[model samples]
Target: MISEPFANKKTWVHSLDPRLRVCTAFFLSCLFAITNQPVLAACALIASALLLGCSRPPLSALLRRLAGVNLFILFLWCSVPFFTPGTPIAKFGPLTCTQEGLDLVWLVTLKANAITLLLIACIGTMSASLLGHALQALRLPDKFVYLLLFTYRSLFVLADEWQRLQTALRLRGFVAGTNLHTYRTVGYLFGLTLTRSLDRAQRIHQAMLLRGFTGRFPAFVLLRFQRHDFLFAILTALFLIFLLFFWNNPFFP
Candidate 1:
């Protein structure tokens, strides 16, 4: 139930201009994607971790976010080593892993960790509503921005509905086991969840129409680029330039 864990923190990251944060994230992501060097990726990941530390969100929240990132990364570790061809490093039964494949795994894991940390540190500080407005200001597609906005709000609503369905099942003495009854009941729950989601979406659309929600969503609080934002921009630019330098340098081999 700890949704949007970083949003409420009274940190300098939270005080940054949402638009600036979004742009920084975009650029950092580009840097991650463009670089093939695992050393550079590892450096970026470390920097991202330090940045996240500065944000000062609760330790539990930090761990939770990292756990989610690593879970997906676990799949990459599992598959990349076996398939990518190079000199064999080790073998498990008949499957052989190569050094090149292991390198690829490192590249993926580092880049993903770097991006996730940066996203949590930068974008996670802002509320979904503010982020939507920021995205609109950045001239991202309206449909995508609105989708992000609605998805953020609706996630909690749908989760609540799911909990209610679980409660209803529990009241009817539903016990989860590997059986036909359990499978049927689980399927029913899924169908009901989908049905409720569709119904809610329809109602939400109608409500928006009634409230004069056109294609454009207006921001109540106008975002201004402040002194701190300027400072952040300067520092971020310097760091990115350093990353560029490192990429071209034959330091780590």
Candidate 2:
């Protein structure tokens, strides 16, 4: 099973309607993505951090996720500074670091972190099944929702099949190494896994058809918008308005 550390939490964030969380995360990400001003990005980042704090995610897990995001940002820092055209601030032999490049990368870093934190707080606190249901409730395309739910289910099946294959290989005294035989064995293992997955998929489809599945899975728990949800919506609206106001008129250089 996929580990969902944040999903089972009883925090206020987890209690909010999944649809509301999804919409909030989407709009916040869009707002953060298009903004080029560092001050606006910084403010957004601070807001996202507060949201994440409300979600009360495990600090260790949050740190791990942030580390992964920053690794990619680190790559951007390495390449973007040298190639962007602007007034040169620093030089290393033929490569020159420009002020514009540094500013651009910094804005990106802030936006990326802010959006990531926001998503982790909002979307990450729900199970994949709940997310799919929320998307369906939000009137997303039926095909897209079906694809997401199916893909998520299929990942577990694939992982199980792969693990069974690995166990078989281990039982047969297979030892991995930097050798042609190991490479061939690994390739054959992947081919067998694919073949088995295809067969399993066919079987599953036939079973679903036998059960009269008409492409729509019913949600067991109906989503209700409570007073808290209304309050959340109001607060989020005010926050967005504040961001917009500051976005146009920054108080700092």
Candidate 3:
């Protein structure tokens, strides 16, 4: 089964309406993506961190997620500074690192971390089903919502099928190696998995039809926008306004 470690937490952040959270995350991600000022990006990162702290997710899981995000940022750090054109700040052999590249990478690092943290604080606090319902409530296209919900459900089935295939391979005395035989065996395994997955999907569709599943899924729990939700929205709006005001006016160069 897929893990939802943060969803079970009973924090104020988790209690907010899922629709509000979804909207906030979407806007924050978009804003941060286009922000170029390092100071503004740093402030956004701090705000995101504070929101994440309010959620109080498990420390280990949070660290693991952040580590995964930074791993990609680390790759950028290794290459971006060398190829960008600007005044040279450092050099090793024939390679040169420039101020412009360093600044650009720093901005990107701050924005990426800020958006990721914001998403975890907002969207990650809810279950997948709740997210789908929230999207529906926000007037997203029915087909898109259906696709999201179905894909989320299918992931668990796929994981189980992959595990079963791996077990069968082990039972047949298959040992992995750096050889053409191993490569061919792995390819066959994937092909068989795909075939089984298609069959399972057909069975699932038939079952859904038998159960009278219409085009839309009825949400069991209705979400309400409470006073606290309004308060949260106001605070987020103010923060966004502040960021916009200082977007190009960095406090410190």
Clashes of 2: 0
lDDT scores of the candidates, listed in order: 0.88, 0.92, 0.93
Please write out the lDDT profile of model 1 over residues 1-253, one tens digit for every residue: 3378888888778888999999999999889877899888988999899888888888897888889989988998898899988999899987999999999888888998899999988888888888899999989999999888888777877887799999999998889999998999999999898889879889989998999988787788689999999999999999999888887787864
Better of 1 and 2 by lDDT: 2
Give one digit per residue, the lDDT tens place, for model 3 in 1-253: 7899889999999999999999999998999999878888898999999999999999999999999999999999999999999999999899999999999999999999999999999999999999999999999999999999889988888888889999999999999999999999999988888888889999999999999988889999789999999999999999989988877674645
Top candidate when judged by lDDT against the true structure: 3
Over 181-247, each residue of candidate 2 has an lDDT whose tens digit, in order, gives 9999999999998899889999999999999999898898699999999999999999899878777
Worst 10 residues of 2 by lDDT: 244-253
The global Cα lDDT (0 to 1) of model 3 is 0.93
Specify the poorest-scoring 10-residue window by lDDT in model 1: 1-10
Q: RMSD to the native, candidate 1?
A: 2.4
Off by over 4 Å in 2: 250-253
Colliding pairs, model 1: none
